[model samples]
Structures are given as structure tokens and as C-alpha cells.
Target: MIKAILFDYDDTLVQTRKTRYQTIYKLSEELFGTKITEKEIDAAWGLPAEEFLLNLFGRFSSDIHYLWSIYIEFSKKDLNIPHLNAFDFIDKYKNFVKFGIVTSSSEKVVLRELNELRVDTNLFLQIQTSDHTAVHKPNPNVFEPIFALLKKENMNKEEIIYIGDSPADYESASKFGFHFLGIAHDDRHTSYFQTGEIPFVRNFLELEEYLIDQYSFI
Candidate 1:
């Protein structure tokens, strides 16, 4: 039986494409006076947000630190990120399966938005942020800790489904031997979804139904 459900944040559990794009565009304009196109910004969606900004603002990681800090301050103001309502489904099955989050977003940024939305971070069994590991997703190393944690719970990768909205998440699940459920509304990973090799849900509500019907065997 399935024993755990791990999720990707940002565009997966919460709607963040617009906010992420706007903040990056704003920061790009402020730092280099160049307005980055949506296509340019979308190209960097699944990677580490800081590293993405670093490349855009120039290779100087040192400069990215300061610029990203300023950008964080700007992000917290009026960020209208909507909770995707998938949490209720998670909570419904809370007693039977472990629910957790693993995301490329930094702890500060994720926690800030979670708090601002009054969402409880403690709902998950474990929340792994970008700061938790040096290697990012699509790298099997990033999921080693999660695998170990689930092992402690006596669950195998086959009994866990990883839900996300990015190619990185897709590859991570494939590499790590977990079932992957792609969410498509973000459209950030649309090209990756074009293959239809993996199962996908267009929105959280559909995902909830999928989990309820498909994994009810748990």
C-alpha cells in the first residue's frame, strides 16, 4: 500500500508562476535595467531560484546574494499566492500516510509565504528546502534524505508518489523510483508534459480526486 505522499511546493501546492515571474522581472529591471521576457524567466523555473537570478544578473554569486535579499523583501509584499486546497486531502488521509514537502525554494521564501497565507508548515512529516541540501532536484542525491526518512517509516519508493509541476520533479521521481503525478496548470512545465508518459492532473482538485480514487487501496 502507498504509505507516503511528497509534494513540490511553488506551482504544485500553491500557485506561484505569476508571482515568481513578476518578482524576477522586477529584480532584473532593478539590477540590470533589462526587462526579462517570460520565455527567458520560464526557462529557469525548475532550478534553484537564487542560482537562476545569479545567472540572469551575471555570474557573480556575491552580487546575487545582495540582489536576491532585496528581491525577497519585495516578494513578501502583496504576494497573492493562493493555497491550492490540496492540503485538505492531505489532512484527510493524514493518519494513514505521511505527507511531506520537498522543494527547490529556499526556506526563508517558502516559510515567509506559508506564514503570510496562514498555512501551517507543521502539517508535513518533513519539509526539505533548498537550504537542506547542496544538490538540487533532478539530482538523485537531493532525494536521498527523503528516501532514508521513508525507509525509517518502512515504506519503499514504490509505495510513495511524488507530485510536482516541473521536469526536475519528473526526473527526480523517475530516478528515485517513485510514482510521479505532474500538475499542469502552472504551465511552467508544459513542454515536459507534452510527452504524456507520466500521469498528470491539471489542478489540485483533480489531484485530490485522483489520489482518493486511485490510492484508496492504502
Candidate 2:
């Protein structure tokens, strides 16, 4: 009876690591006069952009802000990356259920990518961006507004599930009492599951199978 599915935008639906890592590397080089390796940036992937900057530099400064601006500019110039692909199962079942994207990314960039990819916005009942809510992921506040939108549309919480690739995504789903499907194809996600707090799958194909099994029981 699941009526809707909420997806995380970055690593969940689209391959964003390459672009993000490259941007961070460029930023690091510009701000610190040193190149940041992909491994270091990858380690900091789940953090909010500004927090990631602070974590790398140890303090906030004008140069960090300038670098961020440069990264944003770079992100805007090109949205295409080599490995980007929508989840195949989701694409196949696109018409079977309502869909939405919930992410901590800025609305501008999210919309830009969605438009670039030609995602059918009409399939979604609601799309929540970090800027639209007072709190970001790992906090229930992000889900609260989404729930309100669902309730207004007369949808039930039990009829929804959230799929994401981060531990924070699991935390958000747990806080909102939504079923969680963890996507762990990357090392960052694999490392997160080592803590043993949640169950995870290697990719969306595994998620498709897991959902079929879980729903069969319901």
C-alpha cells in the first residue's frame, strides 16, 4: 500500500561525487594553495557544503567563502558528469507511485540538475529542498514540512518510504517514522553501515528487490 517514494537527490538518484569532489579540490587549491585529494573530499561528502569547508580548513574565513562562490559558479557552468544515471527500477516504475525528492542541496542547483536531466516534475507530489525548511537532513524538521504537504494531499505516513545513501538520511527517515532504504554503493556509505545502526543495500537494484520483499508481506 505504499503510495509514495521519497528519494535523496545526490548520490541516490544522480551520481554527484565526481562533480562535487572536483569542485572541492578546486576550492581547496584556490583557498589553501594546496590540492585536496579526492579521498579527503569524499570523506567529507555527507556534510553540508559550508560545514565541509570549515572541517577542511579548521575555521571560517573570507577565502573559504570566496572558494565556495567559485565552486558554485563552476557547478552552474556544467551539470553533466560521466556516471550520472537515474535509478533504473525507479525509472521503470515511474508511473506506479507518487515520487518526490528531498535533499539538503540548495533549491537552485537541484532544480537546475532536474531540468538538465529532464526529470518529470509532474510525477512528484512535493519536492522539498533544504532552503524550503528551517532544518536540513538528520533533523525531523525537513520531514515535517513534507508530511504536512502529504497530509494536506490526504496521504498517510504508513504509505510512504524514503530511500537515501547517507546515515543522516536514515536518521531523518527514523525521526519521521518512515521506512528507510539505505543505498551503500560508495565507500562513504559502506563505512556508515559498519557502525551497525541500520541495514543497507549495495545499490538501487538491491533496493528494488528489498522493497518487493518488504511489500509482499504488507
Candidate 3:
């Protein structure tokens, strides 16, 4: 029986595609003096911000902070774009199933968005954010603490499932032996995750269908 469900932030629970696009576009122009296309932003979206910056510009880049600051400032303003249907749908399971959120976003930003969106933070049993771990998604370290927490709750990996909208999220779940559900928050990102043949749903309504079909209610 499933005892827990973990969710990913950003596109998985909220709409941040335009915010990501704008941030990457501005950073590309300012940092590299060249513009990045929408495809580039989608490809880099799964990567940690600093890791993506270093991978693209290497260690010699002088203003990585400037790029990140601009990105965060713009992203913060994007909190008002709400997608609460997923939360409402999940609430049915929330009563009997433990809920947690694991995301690459920083704690402050996630909290700000949650409050602005009127999402009660207390609904989740745990919320793991970027600031909580040095390593980000696609790396198991970010999820290690989460697993430990669930383990302490007497839930094994098989009893927990992860739902996310990015390749990193899928990869990490696979590496750690958790069942994974992918959401096509963005076509391009979903395409990337689909390459691995992970199961997917386009929206929370579809997700509700999936849960009804694949999982039994407690």
C-alpha cells in the first residue's frame, strides 16, 4: 500500500515556464552577451542554477551572482500564477497518505510562493528545498534526507511515490527506487523525461485518473 507522496515544485505544482524563460533570456544576454532560445531554457531547467551556470560559462565567469540575482528577482514576482487544482486533488489522498515536497528551489522562494498562493505549508509533512542540501536533483543527495524522514516514519521506498515535471526528478526517483509519475508541465521537458519511458500525465486531472487506476485508496 502507498503511504506517502512527494511532489516537485516549480512547473510540477506551479507555472514557472515563462519565469524560467525570462530569467534565462536575461542571464544569457547579460552573462554571455548572446540570447538563449526557449529550448535552451527547457534543457537547463532541470539543472541546478549554479551548476547550470558553471557548466555553461565555466569557472571564469565573473558575474554568476548577478545572473542568479536577476533570475530570483523575476521568479519571485511569478508567485501569483497559481495552479491549486493539483493540491485540491491531492488532498483526497493527503488524509491517509503522507505528503512532502522536494524541489530544487530555495526555501525562501518556495515559502514566498506558497504564502502568496495561499497554499498552507502545514499541509506537507516535509518540504525539502535547495538550501537544505548542497546537491540538487538527478543527484540522490537531495533526496537522501527525505528518504531518511520517511524511513523513520516506517515507510519503505516501495511505499512512497514521487510526482514531478522534470528529468532530474525522474532520474532521482529511479536512482533511489521510488515509483515516479511525470507531468507534462512543459512539452519539451516532458519529452526529455519520456525518453526514459517514465509514466506521465498532462495535468492534475489526468493525475487523478492515474492515481485512481494505479493506486488503491487506504
Candidate 4:
């Protein structure tokens, strides 16, 4: 039986993609003097923020660092993006199973967002962010801390589920032997997971149903 669910922070736990794209695009023009298109940003979605910056800007310079600082400052403001049904989801099943977060995001931003959204971070058994690992998703090392923690608790790989909104999440979980579940909030994710024959859900309600029906998560 699945005993835990590790979540991705950005598009999976919260709806930050569109707003994030807008922020980056606007800042790219202002800071880099390059008017990057939303399409370009979309193409590089799911990468770690610094890697995304390097991928677009072709280097990680002082200006790139400055841009990241500005982005973090911007994130401190209300982007008006509502978190997903994670609060209710965790509250419902938290007693039955452990919860964790594994993301290619920074700990500072993730914690800040969770606080701003009024989520009880204590409900999580562990949180492995980019800061917690030297390498990141699609590389499998990003899951090292969480995976080790689970093993120490006698939880097998099959007993954990990794839920996220991107292919990188699926790839890393697969490589590391955890079950994968996709959050397909848009056509791109839906089509990608469907093409890969991966199981996915449209929202937390459907996710609840999927867990209950498929994993006996009741």
C-alpha cells in the first residue's frame, strides 16, 4: 500500500505557471534586454529556476543572480495565484499516510509560499528542495534525501508516490523506483502523460478518487 505522497511545489501544489511566466517574461526584457516570448518560457518550463535562467540567458552572471533576487522579491508579493486543493487533500489523508515535498525549487520560496497560503508545513514528513540536494530532477539525486528518509522508516519504493505536473518529475521518480502520478492541469501535461501511458488526474478531487479507487487510499 502507498504510505506517502511527495509533491512538486510549483504547478502541482499551486497554480503558479501562468503568473510565473508573466513575471519572468516581463523581467527578462527589463533585466536582460531581451523580450523573451511566453512560448520560449513554456518550452523550458519545469527546469530549476537558475537552470531556466541559464537556459534562456545562456549564462549565469551577476545580472542573472540579480534577476533571480528580483524574482524572489516579486514572489514575496501576492501573485493572486491560489494554491491547489493540497490543504484539504493533506488534511484528509494525513492521518493515514506520511507526506513530503520534493521540488527543484528553493526552500526559502517554498516555505514562504506555504506560509502565505496558510498551509501547515508540519504535516509534511520531509521537504527536499534544490537546496537540500546538489543535483536535481531527471537526475534522480534530487530524491536522495527523501528516499533515504523513507527507507529509514522502512518504507519501500513501491510504498511511495511522487505527484507532480511535469515530465521531469515523472522521469526522476521512475528512475528512482517510486510510483508516479501526474497533475495534468493543462493540455500540454495531459497530452504528454497520456502519450507516455502514465496515470494522471485533472484536479485534487479526481486525485482523491484515483487514490481511493486505485490504491485503496481510503
Q: Which candidate is the best by TM-score?
A: 4
Cα lDDT of model 4 by residue, 1-218, tens digit: 89989998888888788667777766677766878877888777767767776676665364766756777776665463655676788988888999999988777778877787778889999977877888888897788898888888889999999999888889989999999999887776787898999999988999989998898885
C-alpha positional error of residue 148 in candidate 3 after TM-score superposition, expressed in Å: 1.1
**Model 1: per-residue Cα lDDT over 1-218, one tens digit each:** 67888999977878787677777777767765778888877677677867766656654346777867777876776484765666677677687789888998888888888788777777788888888888998896788877788899888888999998888889888787888889888565677678757788888788877887887745
Candidate 3 lDDT trough over 10 residues, lowest sum: 53-62
Report the C-alpha displacement of residue 82, candidate 4, in angstroms: 3.7
Question: Of 1 and 3, which scores higher on lDDT?
Answer: 1
Colliding pairs, model 2: none
TM-score between candidate 1 and the true structure: 0.89
lDDT of 4 at 5: 90
lDDT of each: 0.79, 0.73, 0.76, 0.81
Which lDDT tens digits does candidate 2 get at residues 132-213?
Answer: 7767788866888878877776788888889888888988898888877788767776767768667777766677677778
Q: Count clashing residue pairs per candidate.
A: 0, 0, 0, 0
Question: Which of candidates 1 and 2 is the stronger one according to lDDT?
Answer: 1
Candidate 3 TM-score over all chains jointly: 0.81
Q: Report model 2's TM-score to 2 decimal places.
A: 0.80
Least lDDT summed over 10 consecutive residues: which range in candidate 2?
Answer: 80-89
Using lDDT as the measure, the top candidate is 4
Model 2 regions lying over 4 Å from their true place: 30-32, 37-44, 49-69, 77-88, 194-197
Error of 4 at 88 (Å): 1.1
